[model samples]
Target: MSLLNDPCATPAELADRCEEAGLDLAAAPTSSDLEAVGAFMAQWRRVVACSEHEPRAATLNALMLEYASAPWLTDHAGTGWHLHFREPDVDVPRQIAALISVGTALHLSGLGMDRLGICAAGECSKAYADISRNGRQRYCSTTCANREAVRRHRATRASATV
Candidate 1:
């Protein structure tokens, strides 16, 4: 849920996020690689910005068009066979893009287009892809939800005292 907003994101931070996503990391990402990913994530923000289904789909479709190839199968490095939407020989940034673009498409299609949303808590502005069963997520996490709740309760008490 971190935003690189800058193409000059530090190598370690980029590596950590990639690692958390299960990407194989024999070495740290280079400057250009970080820049490429930063740019891609910028595009990703556009998808998150769209609150409605169609606009989100259109933005994601544009990303898939740019980054993904026709579906293909792979079992590279002894992993179990799985489908991929990217050419086998693409560079790291392109590969990452393909993985994310297709993954996002499936998630939105299977879950709900309204699943991707920003935190409703004041000034938090964090993005979250809601995977909860109920799908009523409004805040990014319990902390934000609690914070907003406290604010509401205090406001109610203050009004009662007036």
Candidate 2:
């Protein structure tokens, strides 16, 4: 499921990761800064994986600065039961981190810690939220499935030709 599904939960880093994965973003990421984004995504991968392995606030804090104060609640009206995590004016990164971290916490505690995962393709490293009825989604998309299938097919044919 798109992390944006949880309007309040989509943290900046998560949004960045989603953007990197070509999911969604308010603006297109600059190609020049891709390396910096890659660094953050690596940490984000750790954060998502930590829920199963070793979820620690210290580790999370090391990845990014902590929220300066407890996030306040704001209701934008008619948006249903969700909370805004930032002050009306704040840096986007901090705002995003708070939203994403809170969203992730809510997601893990409310649903289950095991609901997040990386795609299972051999060379793919995309993240995904298992929001299916059975929560069995593994690959990021059907394209990955097709690619892997083609790879295997080619390998089989190459061996046969040899």
TM-score for candidate 2, residues paired by index: 0.55
Count of clashes, each model: 0, 2
**C-alpha RMSD by candidate, in order:** 2.3, 7.6
| Number of the predicted model whose lDDT against the real structure is largest | 1
* C-alpha lDDT of residue 1 in model 2: 33
* Candidate 1 residue-wise lDDT, 1-162, digit = tens: 554322335777777777776776545678888788878988888887689888899999999999999998878857688887987778768877888788888988999888887889987877888898998888888999999999999999999999
Among all candidates shown, the one with the greatest TM-score:
1
Instruction: Return the TM-score for candidate 1, rounded to 2 decimals.
Output: 0.89
lDDT of each: 0.81, 0.57
Report clash pairs, candidate 1. none
Tens digit of per-residue lDDT, candidate 2, span 1-162? 343222222344454665565332334334423344444445556766554435644555554445434555654454454556545555444444555656666675566666777777899777776677776767777898789889989999999999
Compute each candidate's TM-score over C-alphas: 0.89, 0.55
Q: Give the range where candidate 1 is weakest over 10 consecutive residues by summed lDDT.
A: 1-10
